[model samples]
Target chain A: MEVRDLNFTYPDGTLALEDVSMDVHAGEIVAIIGPNGAGKTTLLLHLNGTLRGNGVVKICGRRVEEYDVKELVKKVGLVFQDPDDQLFMPTLYDDIAFGPINLGLDEQEVRRRVEEVLSEFRLFEYRDKCPHHLSYGERKKAALAAVLAMKPEILALDEPTANLDPKSVRELITAIKKINEEGVTVIISTHNLEILPQIADRIYLMNKTVLAEGESDKILADVSLLERAGLL
Target chain B: MHQEIDKYAHNSPLCNLDPRMKVISLMTLIFSVVLLPRLELVSFALLFSIALLFVSRLPLRFALHFLKWPFMFITFFLLIMPFSIEGTPVFSVGNVIATYEGLKYGVLIALRASSAVILALIMIATTKFGTLLKALEKLKVPNALIQILMFSYRYSFTFAQEFDRMRLAARARGFNPKTSMRTLRVLGSMAGMLFVKSYERAERVFWAMRARGYDGSVRMLSELKAGRRDWAFACFIIAFAALLHLVGG
Candidate 1:
């Protein structure tokens, strides 16, 4: 995945992104770390054509706008921070099957995918329950499972660790690593620095633009850079 | 929190019955009750509704609690009927005549309304809301209407929780509500904030849906299959409704 000279301004005249450029190779876990209002969410929204900015976003060597919207979502699955927003279907089972059903898959295929994700996430017991009934940690996993059921090549998550307990955070990191091992490129934007070194293969520290990009160890060692980005 | 009726519905022995059959049978029963010409026949319908409540295994106390609102609403109209209608006077209070014909008319309306409401409640109390909506969808209800009902039912709980949180926040800040201009102002502001928050949430939800390949329409796995028992139960209920109509006629 590649983004070049991306610039985005909200309708209220706030510049959310400024000439941002980045790249992510296949089978790598990339993390975008920054302070609040750093346009981390806006950038992730552009990955799946949810928002059209002023620059090019390429997935698998094709321009974002070049592929149809339906086809684009299958290639890059974007999970919102709030599971409530993403899991709007009446039940968790329906929510997980939503994307595949929209992809025009047959009923049997959709059911298979939903069952696969439910067992993988250990959410089979709550399949018929409403999303609101699940705990925060379960909701988070269910949201990710909902997106993963589509089998996207690139999974983009916004604030995956926000509002989670320590155990849930660790479990989410492990899940991300497991997904990466299975060959799904993962990109997450978060301000949580504790899990950065553990899950991130590379880190991009940014506040509206690419401040710095390097291996996780190099970025973690740069105190002055972290201070300037407000991580301190 | 789950609604009281929803709890019973999920646990009801009748829950496993196909929702389409349940809806069709109960709806037919409601129509028969409403169409009954004699107040005595309406009594039979009311008895039948009580029988349904028993079969649903819903406790009498819960049913009475659920009936309170509709009964209160219907009472307002029933009170005015005896005073407004022209008939033979049965009694008088402060020159206001209460007539036997008006009393009979009021009783008929009350019985009919109660019977219909009870039957409808039985239908709702035996099926999950989502399954009920799906049954409606399969019964030729428009997809757009079904979608609207589905989302409204699903998000009502979310919004209710949001409102509860705001209320708690107000209480934590030492805010006390009473009937006054100040209280009204605070309430108005809270309502305005809720509207703004809901608007923002709606936009985010739309984006989320689009991200998951949502086109204009929604599709779900239809796991409803009517078996022989469902058909038999539906036939029995419909036949019973016809018998009531015939006996009344």
Candidate 2:
């Protein structure tokens, strides 16, 4: 994945991202680290065409504009920051099957995908449970399962660990690592810097735009850079 | 209010019954009670609903509590009817007379209202809200209307939680709401803020739906099917309603 000179402004005249450029190699776990309002989410939205900006975003050698929203979603699965926002279906199974069903897959195939992803996330038991009834950690996992059921090539997560307990955070880190190992290029935007070295291969520090980008360890060790980006 | 109903719904023995069958059965009973001219037919319908409440294992106390609001409305209607409809006067209060014919008419109307409310409550108590919404969709209700109902039902709980949190925050700040203009102003602002926040949340929710590849029609993971027992139950309800219609006439 590649983004070049991306610029975006909200309708309310707020500059979300300005001249942002980054590249995510296949099978790499990329972390976007920044303070609040640092345009990390804005950039992720651009990757999947959820927000159209003034530059280039290419996935698999094709510009994002070349793909329709549905086609873009098939290749790039974007999970919202809030599980409450992402998991809108009544039950976890339906939430997971939503994408497959929308893709017009057969009922049997949809059911199969829902079960496969639920089991993959170890959320099989919560299949019939309401999303609201699930714990915050479980809802986050269910949100991931909903996206993973689509079998996207690129998995983009926004703040995957926000508001999670330590145990839940550790579990999520392991799950994300396993998902990355399975060859899906993962991009996560988070302020949680402690787990960056453990999970992310590369880190992009941002404050409204990319301030620095390098290997995860080099970026994490740079106290000055972290201070400059208001992330420390 | 919703939590209590949902709790009973989740635990009801008829939870697994097809919502379509329940809707058909209970709606038939409600309509029979409403359209029946005689009190005996309506009484039969009310008795049938009570039996259903018992069969579903819902507490009678809870059901009666749920009925309280509608019962109040029915009582007020019954109370006014005797004075409004003039007929053979039974009692006079300063020229505002209560008539024998009007009393009978009011009692019949109130009975019909109560029977309909009971039948409707039976269906709600035994069905999960999501299943109920899907059943409405399957019944060929308009998609837009169903979607509206679905969102309202889904988020009312979330809104309630938000409201509680806001109230707590206010109380923490030493804001005591009493019957005063200041209290009224504070509540008005809170409501306005809630509306604004909910509007923003709705926008984000729509974008989230779009990201998940949601089309116009919301599809469920599983389709509801009527089993042998469901069909039998529906048949029994229809036959009983028909029998009541004949016998009461």
Instruction: Report lDDT (Cα) of residue B160, candidate 1.
Output: 84
Measured against the true chain A, the candidates' chain A TM-scores are: 0.98, 0.97
Second chain TM-score per prediction?
Answer: 0.92, 0.92
Could you say which candidate leads in lDDT? 1
Candidate 1 interface RMS: 0.9
Clashing pairs for model 2 are none
DockQ of each: 0.78, 0.60
Report the Cα lDDT for candidate 2.
0.86
Cα lDDT tens digits, model 1, B105-220, are 88888888998899888888778777787799789888888889877877787888888899899989998999999989998999898888889998998999899998988777
Instruction: Name the fnat for model 2.
Output: 0.50
Error of 1 at A204 (Å): 1.8
Q: After superposition, how far is residue A39 of candidate 1 from its true place, in Å?
A: 1.0
| Model 2 TM-score relative to the real fold | 0.93
Best by TM-score: 1
Q: Please, what are the lDDT tens digits per residue for candidate 1 over residues A138-165?
A: 9999999999999999999999999999
